[model samples]
Target: MKLWGGLSVLGLVYAALAFGIDQTFKWWMLHVFDIEARQPVALLPVFDLVLAWNKGVSYGWLSGDASQDLLIAMSLAIAAGLWIWLAKATHPMTAAAIGLIIGGALGNALDRAVYGAVADFFSFHIGSFSWYIFNLADVAIVAGVGLLVYESFTEGRAR
Candidate 1:
């Protein structure tokens, strides 16, 4: 298949995963357990499944007082730009990376649109400090970034 075709397929797949799986999980978390309920399902000693909401960016920055309207607007803009960029991507790996990033952005953007906040349910803790709660969308974004970085380094080596 052509690069454009592959990109389209991958992008749609990513978007579907983000929309279907993430939203379903969010709905369950919100409707079944409620946002404020905290029950630790231990994945490991340092990790737990605990429901939390983030009204702002990563690590809950600007969470308390940030304007929801501004955040949603920015997210929409970013997702659009990213989608266009992903569509234009010529390399399979680049398209995949951008698709993942776009998926993540869309997932969080949907949350903000629907809930006025991002639903973050996974939490990690160690000894004295607890990591900020986050969701699968955040993981996808981080993994996308990691793949992009790896691509950059490996691209240079392959040339």
Candidate 2:
């Protein structure tokens, strides 16, 4: 497949999956589980699945306000720009990174557009300390960023 086509496909797949998974969990959380009911499905002693809703971006910044529309616009702008770049990426890894970032941004953008807040539920904790509740989209963004950094460094080394 062509680079842009591949990236577009990947982005679409991730976006769909992210949307489906996030919405399902949110639906269950709102309907099935009370916000405070912690049913710890411990992946490890230090890591457990607890539901949380975040109003803002990853780690919960700028969550609540009238600025949700603005946030959605900015996210869409960024994702659209990245989609354009994905069309131009010569390397597979580069395309993949762009795909992931585009998908992730689109996922959150949808949330902001529809709900005025991103739904974040997935908390990892270690005793008194814990990470912010986040969703699959956030994971994709972070992974994409790591891949982009790796690609950049490798490309630099090659040149």
TM-scores, all models, native as reference: 0.86, 0.77
Model 1: per-residue Cα lDDT at residue 44: 92
What is the per-residue lDDT of model 1 for residues 11-109, given as tens digits with 9 covering 90 to 100?
767666765677788888778866556576678999988776688897767665357778878877887777777767767777777777777888888
lDDT digits (tens) for residues 1-159 of candidate 2: 233554566655655665566566666765677544665556787776665555666556676777687778888889878877777767778767776777778877777776667766676778899877777778878888899999989989999
**After aligning candidate 2 to the native by TM-score, how far in Å is the CA of 29 from where it should be?**
5.4
Best-fitting candidate, measured by TM-score? 1
Enumerate residue pairs that collide in model 2.
55-63, 56-63
Number of clashes found in candidate 2: 2
Model 2 regions more than 4 Å off: 1-43
